[model samples]
Target: MQKISQKSIHKYLRHDKKFPHVWCPGCSNGIVLGAVIRAIAELDLKKDNIAMVSGIGCSSRMPVYADFNTLHSLHGRAIAYATGVKMYKPEMDVVVITGDGDATAIGGNHFIHAARRNIDLTVILINNYIYGMTGGQYSPTTPHGDKATTTPYGNIDPTFDICKLAIGAGATFVARTSAYHAVETQSFIKQAFKHKGFSLVEIISACPVIYGRLNKKGDAPTMMKQMKDDVIPIKQYEKLSPEQRVNKQTRGIFINDTEKMEYTLAYQELIDSLKVPKGDSNE
Candidate 1:
């Protein structure tokens, strides 16, 4: 028997053409990308069977580097595109790559509807707490007092609890993890892909170039350590009262395997039932 090297996963090298990715040296997008690839490899999915869709942002550029059927669509529309792809090709694995702004700002509506319909797609939302692509603007997930390009004086808006929103909007699987938790993040991605209904893995990534520098959140290591310190696992979160978990960075799966009719299969069943007989029995 011949030996195989799992460490040399082919998909990891798919970014060679665009080597030296656009993200900054300390940015965690690369880490998150690795997690996605590792998850796909572990799932044993063929490149042709997976479709990676991304919106317009630093996180949105993931599709360009992955060796899969990919679509780099407009900002805030990745979920919309992924929804269409899943509807037309229900068997294909569809994963959406979006940033904090792309997922919860302009793309919020699409995100909501996709979860509401229980679309069978995996959404990897990289939340760096700001618009990394667009001049470090305060995003929907930016902390209330964080500073951004637009919020030089400090952001006064409340942040969106991404995993909670996904669960509330009807996603069947919702999990929270950070880029620093590389192995766990990969495992979560695999779980998301394996799930039958809408699944979202909210990844807290580091944006040292923009978000971190603007907000004085320290270098990449410091920011990552912050997440490591603040985030709590799902079981631990469950132990806390509602007031205790308030404004906390909760990690782990919020929902898993909740029975829901997947949108694509439901649609197919509807069409199948609507088919009329070609001829009456008496005819």
Candidate 2:
């Protein structure tokens, strides 16, 4: 793969209009954005052919900065809008930028159904544990014992394993990586873009301002270092004993099923089947 330079990826950004992004200093959203830009640059995809869709959240602000056909949609509705875009213009590459609360909470139904249909869309779900943008509420993926503004004492809810959820929902391509692992994240995203059906990349991101301050996870660099230590490669994780695997997160492609037919193609096939022969139309 060719090395991507910061200058090269600038063309993909709306630098003049969206300069000084809204994300907090040291927020991993920027890291994810860099990975995404690098991946698109590596793929050599046209800017016009890509559509960046986002819902409400800090991560969801990505579409505002990207120069692609961007759609900043309602809370938890990025997938729904992306599905419409894909159905209407199946040729365009639709990428959804969403956060933990925005994706697995109110948007849960849309997320599952889209995966169940196996539509052609790339969903980059940034899991930052708490609802960083909406006042640090505990999200669907917040750890059971984590502290959030909503859960002052501590959370009692079990966290959702995003990759497993996607796989169970019938997404053809599912992967997980952290913002700390930029190279791996970029590689997975590239693979997701190339996949023909529903693809999800769950990126473990950091919200140092809110989630970090609440959970005492330390500064952004410390959190990133912890991620480097905690998330292991899937191959290495599989080799570990059950006891050894405790509290460890694995990063890598979890699923890539190429056999299932894409939703748009199937819909088009159904449309073609319904059409009567050219000379055999009912009078």
Which candidate ranks first by lDDT, i.e. highest? 2
What ranges in model 2 sit over 4 Å off? Answer: 279-283
- The collision pairs in model 2 are none
Please estimate how well model 1 matches the true structure, expressed as its whole-model Cα lDDT: 0.87
Alpha carbon lDDT at 181, candidate 1: 88
Q: Per-residue lDDT for 1-283 in model 2, tens only?
A: 6799889988988868678888898799998999899999999999999999999999999998899999999999999999999999999999999998999998999999999999999999999988887779999988888999989999999989988999999999999999899899999999999999999999998888899999999999999998898788999999999999876899999999999999999999999998877966666
Enumerate clash totals for all models, in the order shown.
0, 0
**Alpha-carbon deviation at 2 in model 2, angstroms:** 1.2
Note the Cα lDDT for every prediction shown: 0.87, 0.93
Write out the backbone clash pairs for model 1.
Answer: none
Q: lDDT of candidate 2?
A: 0.93
- lDDT tens digits, residue span 169-193, model 1: 9999999999888888998999999
